[model samples]
Target: MKLTALKTMAATVALGVSMAGAAFAADLRIAYTGYSTDNTFWIGVAKAAAARADEMGVELLDLTASSPDAAAQKDAVDRAINMGVDGIIIGSVDNRAFDASLDSAKRKGIPVVAVDTGIEHDHVSSLVQTDNLAAATIAGGYIVDQLDAGTVLILGGSAGHQTGNARRDGVKNAAEAAGHEVIFQICDWQDACAYETTVNFLQSNPDIKAIFSAWDPGALAAVSAASELGKLEDLVIVGFDGNPANLVSIEAGEQAATIKQDNTRMGAEAVSNLIGLIKGESVPAFTPIDGILITSDNVAEFK
Candidate 1:
């Protein structure tokens, strides 16, 4: 009887140890960085990614920069590397500035995946982003189709940011393809800056018929500028990112349209790619998420 009792206790203890080992073995840490949580679009992406990480039994540590400063972002990446995370995901302010840091992460045996924006270096294991250029082209085409005969103004983001440049090029290409002339200006992605630039542009060119902004805030700025000038009806404003605020503008007829990027899908795909890399599975280096053009006609669908 004593032998039986001893055998049962030994078996129980062994099972307990095995379960603990499995629990410890299942832990994975991922570091994520992006622009800021102040924007609803980014907040939604972060929340969905966190939920996905929970579902996958992995731990995600979010590291955000105060602003869109590359130096601060690089610091966040370095901190993540020092923490020895299994993988790191970044939406870089500048694609080329992080090459050395990415190389360092690769040397540390950590896979790096870029989300929403890309890195120029080959050290990044994968990239998951929306087709920004195509989306911009769609926005431009929408604007051109809406207005009959008037000038369209382009409000762009920072000069060096690759995403901003791609968006600008797309809008320009599409507008030219449609045989419409575009008056373009760079706003550094700040709402105040965009507002000021838009107001100035409107003052100088009151006949501006449409405005296409590369981001939601910039679009809102254009809307505000137009409303203040009592030209909201004459101006058709379009934006990217399909933010909740922009949706309100669309519903109110203050803004014409926006391009919706599936950021949740972006986050989930990035995590999946990282897992594949961890498992030694071959994964595509670049993954492009398609965008949907949202206008008042189909804004309900997006909501």
Candidate 2:
């Protein structure tokens, strides 16, 4: 959509008015596919998307994948396409794995809006996600400012995932630039793996002064591991995806900082973008939402 139209959509969605609630010519059916139901962040995204769909009087099909795997998520998209939904919204498991399904959607004239994870397909109308690189840089800068130069461990997301890679790169760039030795580990977005990795890494590298987790759960896992190893007091911990539990950790002074994404806004905005594309209106290729860096000094506002 044009800049003016995009602004109008944002205002309407943000204010619950602008024009989102207006009657549509026909009932629109949009399929929403989240990464997984058990994930806290995706749960919030799904709830917001459902709320927005309700506000717009559209039918939202919850075709969320049961597992956090490329095959399962791709299957969900295929199901949505076979059902002939007007448009699709996805928090993709792997952006590169949906080529065939997205091509089919394009052939069928079904527009797609991606939330969180971006799919680089012409059929995908827009991507609404956190500005991860910028947010993680801020988080990294916070870590750099808080501690003396030393080893900084990064608990990263799954390999090859765009969102996770960006977060990893952001922090890595900042830490390396500041002359801190960086240790990287891929948790594959798994809590158990993160916990184990943190414990093992800290055991061998006692001089490590800080840890940056790409996701909140990973950060919490780090907190747990550090507490078990008696390293919590000596380390500065930072995380992304301001999950409630991580915020609680911050409130308790366990985690030093986090980059909190507006997941709710992402969901609602994805819905708005999908509707626009369904109506044959042009939508922007990307919409970057800023993340708030939550620290102990201001964790209360988020908590």
Candidate 3:
């Protein structure tokens, strides 16, 4: 009887040790959603996140919508929830569209993190984003200073995107407050639309001295449009998102400036925060990353 009891006690101890090891080796599943996979910015974020997940031995599944559409992004989040991921990172297409989905995730005890664009839902455990408004304000101030109160054309993304509206409002408020006339155009974050809109604006408003685009691709398109219209030299084009193409444009004196957001860092930080939450750790609800202004004066530093 004593021998049998000793064997049972030893088996219980061994089983407990095995269970602890399994818990430690459990894979963390993550789901990510964003606008489109084509943009260099989003691509960098995805690559960085994937690399980190691999290093940590975590399972990551990326989901991208046809475009920056709210409904599509929400569907992706819903799918992640149904699949029972440990955590989720959302690049919200529209800030308000993911409230219900996020709420559902929270109900299921899964943590949600927002990257690039923030969501309005209270369930979002954390947000990692750049200071977009501050960057736009800098761009606006630079344009006003260079043009000396001339007409400034503002090219923005889709109508309802929070990032788009924030940037547009920042530039418009700054320029208008400084006694400069602001003309706003919506390109829906499409390069082709930006190109066409820029061409039409240039033809109609010959006196427009500067153009501020919300992203590098749109700015590059505007630069091409200006060149086609023989107004490249006369137009001062500023943009956000310090993409490699925009940096090249800055070096070539084609674009006046761009705002640099550390997309890789943002992605890595989002993953780290979500992992912490999965482990039942505390995380901040919002994490605002800084932005740097890139121009010919300091473009070499970034390059």
Could you give candidate 3's per-residue lDDT for residues 1-303 as a string of tens digits?
999999999999999998774565366788988766888899888888888777767788999875667688888999999999999998776777877887799899999998988777778879889878887888887887787657899898877777888789888998899988899988888899889989998999887899999988999999999999999999889988889999999999999999998999888888888888888889877778888889899999998
Per-candidate TM-scores read 0.90, 0.91, 0.89
RMSD in order of candidates: 4.8, 6.9, 5.1
Cα-based lDDT for every prediction: 0.84, 0.90, 0.86
lDDT of 1 at 95: 70
lDDT of 1: 0.84
In candidate 3, which residue ranges exceed 4 Å CA deviation?
1-25, 66-69
The top-ranked prediction according to lDDT is 2
**Greater-TM-score candidate between 2 and 3:** 2
| lDDT tens readout by residue for model 2, 1-303 | 599999998877877653443545146899999989889999999999999988888999998866687798889899989999999998987788999999999999999899998777777779999999999999989999987868999998888888999999999999999999999998888889989999999999987999999999999999999999988999999999999999999999899999999999999999989999888788878999999999999999988
Report the poorest 10 consecutive residues by lDDT, candidate 2: 17-26
lDDT of 3: 0.86
Model 3 clash pairs are none
**Ranked candidates (TM-score, high to low):** 2, 1, 3
Which candidate has the top score in TM-score? 2
Stretch of 10 with least lDDT, candidate 1:
19-28
